[model samples]
Target: MKATIRWAGDVKFEAESGSGHTVTIDGPPDHGGKNQGVRPMELMLLGVGGCSSFDVMHILKKSRQDVTGCVAEVEAERVDEVPAVFKSIHLHFIVTGRALKEAQVKRAVELSAEKYCSASIMLGKAGVDITHSYEIHEAAE
Candidate 1:
């Protein structure tokens, strides 16, 4: 619910979440940064993937799906302007399981995108052109 960001040096910042977790945000050397950590924009996009992945896993578990692994791969585009804000973002989920029902997997993804994932939903509401897609793979024996 709360967080703080402090300057760690030139073009670098450290963010501490309310839960006491910390992460470093830095830019490329061309931007006067040492490139010691993730960029702020990358972190923001990752947050959306994390939020959506959490929701999908939770829903699948609740439904008793035999989940083996899950990965949310994120991609984005930024406008070619001074601010360079995100213009669109896409999430491609690769879900693995044993005998995973296609309908259930589809439903889980839809639920996360439409109802549960707060980060993506918030960005969507802010006109960020958010989109989602998914593929299911059976676990290896």
Candidate 2:
């Protein structure tokens, strides 16, 4: 569970994970960055989204739900003061499958937010207002 970030110049960095994954991070031009890649805060939000989405899909699979596709759309707000931090975060999951049970979808989302997703739990403990919701769409035969 480790990563390294190297300064690439002008508010830009190369981030490498312990698992051999890499990403480029940079700020916008207004912040002295070239806008070369995703902002660091944006990456954090994405990490949270990916973490919770993984949990949701796993839970649904374990419950024998016929899930075919899933996407999590995350939105967050940050404080305007110095040392700005996330004030609120919302995750909207759109899950697609054939005859997906509404109860199953609801339960999976609840389980991820309340139990399985470590990222969400960590943010929750840090006083971030994390909320979850979902929509289930049946695939056409």
Candidate 3:
């Protein structure tokens, strides 16, 4: 519910969450950063991906799906003018499992986007054109 961002010099910062987790954030060299860590915007996108992926995996596991691996690829567009912000974002989930049910996969994705994944919901409410799609890969029997 709370976090802190402390400057670590030259456009770099250390962000810590209330739960004691921390991550480094920095800008590109052109913006005076040393490129030591992920960009702020990149972190935002990553957060959303992580959030949704977590939900999907949890839901699938609860359904007794033999989940093997999962990956989320996210793409976003930003405004061209000053104070640039994300205008749209798309998430593609690639889920791998043994005999994974297509309907279950679809339902998991839907549950995350519509019921869970607070990050995506918040961004969507902010007018970001957030969209989701998914592919399911069955593992070799």
Candidate 4:
């Protein structure tokens, strides 16, 4: 529930979480960075993906779906104005399982988007166009 960001050098930082996890953040070299770590913006988007993915996996498991793998591909667009905040985001989830039920997958995604994923809800409240879709793939034998 808490984190701290410390400046490592020009355009670079080390962010530590309350759970004793650390992540290196940096910008591109053109912005006085060494490109040694993930950009802060990228991390934010990835957090959204992570949050939603966790919800989807948990839901599927609880539903007794034979889930084998799940991948979330996130895409976004930012305005050209200063600050360049995200304008829209689309999350495409590829879910793999043995005889995965489409309805179950759809329901899980809907639940995450509408109720569970806090990151997506926050971004949507900030006027970001958030959308999601999923494709279920049959697990190999």
Clash count of each predicted structure: 0, 0, 0, 0
Candidate number with greatest lDDT: 4
- Highest TM-score, which number? 4
* lDDT by candidate, in order shown: 0.94, 0.94, 0.95, 0.97
* Cα lDDT over the full model 1: 0.94
> What TM value does model 4 have?
0.98
- For residues 1-141, could you state the per-residue lDDT of candidate 4 as single tens digits? 999999999999999999999999999999999999999889999999999999999999999999999999999999999999999999999999998899999999999999999999999999999999999998889
Q: Model 2: clashing residue pairs?
A: none
> What RMSD does each model have against the real structure?
0.8, 0.8, 1.0, 0.6
For candidate 4, the per-residue lDDT at 137 reads: 92
lDDT of 1 by residue, 33-130 (tens): 99999998999999999999999999999999999999999999999998888899999999999999989999999999999999999989988999
Error of 3 at 51 (Å): 0.6
Off by over 4 Å in 4: none
C-alpha positional error of residue 70 in candidate 3 after TM-score superposition, expressed in Å? 0.5
